[model samples]
Target: MKGINITSITLYSTVAFSSLFRSCAFQVVPTGCGGSRQPSTPSTSTGIGIGTGIEPAPTNSNTIHNNHVMSDDSFGSRRQLITSLVPSAIVTATGVSILLSPQLSFAEDVQVDPVIVDPVIVAPTGEIKKLFNEGRALEQQGNIQASQRIFAKVTKLAPRFIYGWAYLGNSQVALGSLDPAENSYTKAVNLCVESRKEEEKLGIPRCNDLYLLYLNRGSLRLNNGMAMAMAKEALLDLEAADSLRAKPDAVILQNLARAREVNGLYAASDRDYTVAISMTSNEVSPFWLRAALVKFQLGDTMGSFDLIRRVENRFSEAPEVRAALAAMLYAKGDQDIDTARKKFLEIPDRQRLKYRNDEFLLNTISWPPRMIDNIKALSDAVGDAGRVEI
Candidate 1:
């Protein structure tokens, strides 16, 4: 993303689940911008850094002079290298050309128009398009099995059809096949990258396809051992695509923060959630969640409680948010029987089944344990973290 004017990184990374909030600011990657987009270099080849958020920029492929990093595919290793290279001070570049590698310069000093290439028609004899249409129809009809089958056919018919791969992944997710869904998304991303190399086209569709793929994959990685790293990569990809498209898209950023939160990267998660809230519309859930979690981690019990109250005032009907609040109240040892009864009643009947048949929750609390104790402990953790309580 060199030579590109990132007028507002904040505008693009908005808070999700809240449906409201908005703000904008410029964010500079202080360390460097390398990895995935460019070829790999020696460990010393590039660095990475980031600045505060900003408003949305115009959509274009224009080059901007600024810090850039060597292209690298190994995202985890590349991030470390970039972090080590950027200065602690706020990074600034007006029109300076930063070299990431011998071939790629961060900014060219001279403006060069983006290269546009025609998309290669990879659909096989109309079969790929047919399969894509069938997949969509099946999905709309709630026939996930049939949709996946159709999409699978599309991918086989035209492996390079990016949409085919993206749709296939989406269907796989609906079918609860997370691993296969991830693999499908990965195929789409690979096609996007390969298409760019072959066609010199950086269209919004390709970027969007790649962005969605990363977002879904990161979500799948939320509870896994690689959660932190996968979430970071997904967030980076989301930011890059948002920047390139010059559109405000807070959902990806919000989810990115949640992924970090789930993995216990509290500091990183808090920052992302805060930024997302600042950049979106007036809904307050993200702020409540992140702020409350930070307060809880800091041992400020009341602060977390206040956040839960605020969320309840706004999103009481939201099952996830309510569940979290109930968990929080229980944790604080607030034992008013009437209030507990009311809170318990407030939990959706559908979700309440977990109190009976959920093996994990049952095991965690030592099966058939006192309902009150379960409520308090789970609530506190959920409310503090602004996460859904089971």
Candidate 2:
């Protein structure tokens, strides 16, 4: 690397970096009145060391700015070549410096043609970060549509950015755009895996966002339907989330349990539900309710009712408690549907004013498909007779 022109790249028989990295080749555009300046034969391979303050090759009034650097090649930058060469490395330089990465073994005494490459410098994330922040702020202010537009721009700018794709999926889910949301989440999942793979190569631990990405996608697939294949897929995603977790998380376990149950893995579902029940603190009622349903499916009918009774007695005043437990029991078809109907329908209109819609049962509770169908059936069963009068 000693005394080589700063404008020239050391082309060799051996690659300098890991083969996993894609090359950032610059278009080699020759200059001068002649077609191309013959490059000097590359020196015998040896250790690479960075040097400073060497002047760029002379050109016929060829002024190259920072944005557009040309080295007889359509692109070349002293800084960018260094940046692209070192992955997961921190580089702090005083002035203009050239880099030659270590661990690149060149064939001994093999003379090769030297080529200057215009590195495909990746755009800095500052602008994308700023836009992402703006989008997040809009989301906080409840302007989902505007944030959606901004995140769309973010993804377009940096297509591989994981958080951008994840947040875009979030916005689409909020806007009732299920298909688009699924696609965005799928894209984010793939990018997240790639990011984690790179992180592993750098010897860094896995990121925390990965589990949440799986959780959201799995939940979407679970609540969307109880199709055997989709439930199996949701189970796979939730299990992936579980594996990534450092410890048991109640919400993730709850979703995982549901996915497991839908796939008919009763024992595994029961275990996940039990863990969720133990982990739950603030939302203990929902976890127990799900556990109760799982027990009912596992043939512990009396035990399931006892758990449901415990929730009813504890959270008697909470309408969701009544609605969720009642819908599940009513759907079982063998129980006293009338009593369960009364449990769900008897809430007063004044209280019903706040819990007037399906959002609470569908979203807050996030009942699985079969359970949601049962809830819908319970709603239709009583009709106006069950509808509370103000």
The numbered model that scores best in lDDT is: 2
Candidate 2 per-residue lDDT, tens place, 340-367, comes to 6888777655543323345543433444
Number of the top TM-score candidate:
2
* TM-score to true structure, per model: 0.49, 0.53
User: Superposing all C-alpha atoms, what RMSD in Å does each candidate have to the true structure?
Assistant: 19.0, 24.3
lDDT for position 84 in model 1: 27
TM-score of predicted model 1?
0.49
- Model 1 RMSD to the real structure? 19.0
Instruction: Assess the local accuracy of residue 146 in candidate 2 as a C-alpha lDDT between 0 and 100.
Output: 89
Q: Which stretches of candidate 2 lie over 4 Å from their true place?
A: 1-124, 199-208, 225-229, 313-390
